[model samples]
Target chain A: MNALLNKEMRLSASILSYLFIGFGLMTLLPGYPILCGVFFVTLGLFQSFQSAREANDIVFSALLPVAKHDVVKGKYQFSMLIELSAFLLMALITLLRMTVLADSSVYLQNALMNANPFFLGVALLIFGLFNAVFIGGFFKTAYNFGKPFVSYIIVCFLTICAAEALHHVPGLQALNAFGFDHFALQMLLLLGGALLYAALTWLSYKKACENFEKIDL
Target chain B: MSIVELKDVCKTYPAFRLHDVSFSLESGKITGFIGRNGAGKTTTIKSMLNLIHTDGGEISYFGMPLSGHETEIKQRIGYSTGTVSWYPRKTIRQIVDVTRTFYRSWDEDAYRKYMTLFGLDESKKPMELSEGMKVKFNLLLALSHRAEVLILDEPTSGLDPFSRDELLGLFQTLREHGVTILFSTHITSDLERCADNIIYISQGEIRAECSKADFLKNYGNPGETLEEIFLRLEREAKS
Candidate 1:
């Protein structure tokens, strides 16, 4: 836990120093899925940093006494924590921004619904967490990305559009309407994202470990 | 009992293949795994660490199959390689901080001591260092870890003579403490200065393995001077 926290601190300090406000914006969504999306993007960035540092993160990590899965678990959890923090910060900003809207209580302004903290969070979560992590995991395990920048950008844009489409669905959109005070709903969303991230993390770890054993370092 | 043992371990891929190689390093000694580039030194080390999957045979470390007691065994073992790469922006100190998290017996003070001893700028990025310094830095990192066994693959592959001597001196001190250093190197003189035993590998097989001193005593040369012995043995095995 200390290691995870320490790495987080180190990373957060560096990110903070860089004034990476996009990452900061990513956290602001109120919906759980969007928050998860922002979190996974953050993890993708972190893994990129690791890949830059060590040509092979899996190989170097396997060299440690640490099991492959635990390492992945630690990284995924850290991503979630960062996401949670980002979303909280963003939610506060959105709440402040929401106050600017005239007559929000009667019916949410159509414009605000489009950019609503709650809905935006859901959108980002689906787009960022699910899409980014799967592609990143594929590249990471395969020891190479298909096209790097082109693939990532295309995927990011497509996922954002898909999440936006999903938001218009009457059934799914209602889940995010559990307005301000229903803290339990918010927790559940985050927990669901966490569980999904954890599951993916375990699968990626196993694949990488199996690959590491056969890898000629 | 063998402190590190691998019997007929095989790992295969499209381009790379680690055949059924077998060797063991007994406790309380240095075992030099000498192989040229692509001779499977790193492959063998990776297998010991469970970094790769072996298709055939058993690999026992610290008296247990690798799958049996990985954590307990790995914690007691130190591993390093000549191939060192790092995040271009992270400093040596930051890397050390990252490494400290996994091991139960992380020697922070020793880590700092080695950082200073090597004259490595703890504040500088690993990628910024020269190749020799990079290798040295990695070596120092391995040395500082409070592991009972050291498994170094080409530990001194790119060091200057002075740094090489410094590393040998460090290894000598470690051996005195019964640390059991196992390093693979092509530098025969480096092995002559420190290794108690040698495992000469060729064509995916351990062609020769014996005490450095005894082999030299019988061969009438210091530490099996000629490559012909290994070549001949390899040929004999094939025929």
Candidate 2:
């Protein structure tokens, strides 16, 4: 735990440089899926890329008196911390729009409450898949710069493009219609997303630890 | 008793391999790990620290197995590499503040003492410091925790002679205070001045591990230095 705290503090130094701009963009995006997409893609890939460029990042941490496994745990914890913060900030922005824009206040609030969970569910899936590939690949090679990062960026770009395109599809509209209006369905979506996020996160953490332990610095 | 021991440690890379390296550093002595570039000195050190996973063999530090007691053993061990580690943008103070939280036995007074002695500016970032200054800063961090054993990789590569001498003097002082020191460097003169023991590695294998006195006595003739002896030995090993 102490090791994780120390690592988080170190990671915070790197993450702070990107936080403001990432948060600002999150606040600016009005559409739910797009906002979540941008948030997940930008925060996730950017931080991982920052870490990769540091090259000696994991080696430096490994030299410390902490367990290597704790280093992996710290990374997952830090990523989740950023994602959770973005989620909260987006929620706040949605609230502000609900109250300040009175004409669409009820509609926006209703849309946010009902539709957001589904979008976040989709966000969870994307974030989970992104981490599995990124973390697994990064740690496995002990961080080679090009392959993992650029590939993940392409994946994220394609995912966001596909989701944004799907928003207008007539067939999926029926599913979105129910998902965006029903409280129970939205809660289910949120729960399901949360579970997927947690599971992928744990799997990534475990995978990272295994890969890192095999690395000879 | 030895403060650190490596028994038949093996590691492999695509281009290089460490072949069953074995050595031991007794407590409160300075052991100079010497070799040419890419001769497995750093690989041996990294394997002992478990930073580089070993394919075979065992390493023990402070009388405990390295694998089982990594955290505890590392707590007593201080290490620095050739390059400055940590974020380049972070000020010395910021890095220190963050790093101090990892160790329970971090000595604030020792830190302040070294920081003052080194004339390290708390506000300056790592990249702003000269290479010599960076090494000193890293030594300060390693020494600040009252570490029982210090392992450094090429700690005096790019420094002026005065800075190198001062660092060597500090190593002697720390040795007198009962801290074991193991450092790898190509600079034979530094080791000649302060090393109690010399461990020579070449071509991924340890050629010799002996007291400095025995090394000069055995391999060196009158007026021959460690540099000359190292060259002769390396040539012999190759032949």
Please give the TM-score that candidate 1 achieves against the real structure. Answer: 0.77
For B1-239, candidate 1 gives per-residue lDDT tens digits of 57888899887767777788888887778887776767777777778777766778798877788786786787888888787664556787777778777677788788778878888887898778888888877777677668889988788877889989988998888888888878887776788788888887766666667887665665434445534444444466569
Where does candidate 1 chain A have its weakest 10-residue lDDT segment? A106-115
Fnat values, one per model, are 0.50, 0.58
- Residue B103 local lDDT, model 2: 83
- The digit string of per-residue lDDT tens for model 1 on A1-217 reads 5664455456323453223334546433433233334434454554544453344444555566665444444444554555555556566655554455323443343311333444444534543443345434543544554454345555555655665565467766643342453445545755664555456555655664444344444
* lDDT leader: 2
- Best of the candidates, TM-score: 2
The segments of candidate 2 whose C-alpha lies over 4 angstroms from its true place after superposition are A1-3, A9-41, A92-114, A161-174, A178-180
Q: Top model by DockQ, which number?
A: 2
Backbone clashes in model 2, listed as residue pairs? none
Query: How many Å off is the CA of A69 in candidate 2?
Result: 2.3
TM-score of chain B of 1: 0.88
lDDT of 2 by residue, A44-162 (tens): 54565465357356766777788777667666666666666665665555444434542453344433222345555666666665667666577786667457666767776676666
